[model samples]
Target: MGIFGFFILAAAGYFLYRNYFTTNTYETKDERYNAARAQRQKELDGLLDKINRRGMSSLSERERQRLDELSGK
Candidate 1:
């Protein structure tokens, strides 16, 4: 029973650590930049969808500039 209790407590602690204490640690600048670029691409895709459904006018100035910057236009 003591061994079982220790295993249960260890499992719980492991889960808590994973859920609350883990941090993203990139190994290199390129890795971080690629992650950021992918996130921006996701955002740009969402904006493009919005533009398709509505129009360019639907985008705020900040969003439009972001789109242009991402597209290198």
Candidate 2:
């Protein structure tokens, strides 16, 4: 290829790589909050399952407090 053609191909490749391979992490405050809430929900579900199988008495004090805090009580 000619020099001009080579530079054109290089620029196109650079732009394509930047668009498709770069990480996008531009979360708004609400989006970040929702993601955190989802994670907490997953954790709470696991804890609740443990309580169901083993009874509430099986939960450590820290785990029970976390449950109360998460349940908004």
Candidate 3:
């Protein structure tokens, strides 16, 4: 019974620590949005470069779908 109580207390403490003490990678909504936009643009550029070098046929089905998504098709 004592060991079980200790385990419950430790679990609750861990939950509180994780929920209240963890720091987010981005500090604000605008910063997070900009970072995501930059990453998407970088990926789009790489995909376009691949197509330019190897032709659109070289893109796998997944890559083609990703291109459509990034280009807002």
- How many pairs of residues collide in each model? 0, 0, 0
Model 2, span 1-73: residue lDDT tens: 8999999999999998898789586789999999999999998998999999999999999999999988889
Clash pairs of candidate 1? Answer: none
Off by over 4 Å in 3: 1-26
lDDT of 2 at 51: 92
Query: How big is the RMSD of model 1?
Result: 5.6
- Model 3 lDDT per residue over 1-73, tens place: 6999999999999998887778554469888889999999999999999999999999999999999999999
TM-score of each candidate structure, all chains considered together:
0.58, 0.67, 0.65
Give the C-alpha miss distance for residue 61 in model 1, angstroms: 1.3
Model 2 weakest 10-residue run by lDDT = 18-27
What local distance difference test score does each model get? 0.91, 0.93, 0.94
Q: Please say which candidate is ahead in TM-score: 1 or 3.
A: 3
Candidates, ranked, lDDT: 3, 2, 1
Best by lDDT: 3
RMSD after CA superposition, every candidate: 5.6, 4.6, 3.5
Please identify model 2 stretches exceeding 4 Å from their true place: 1-21
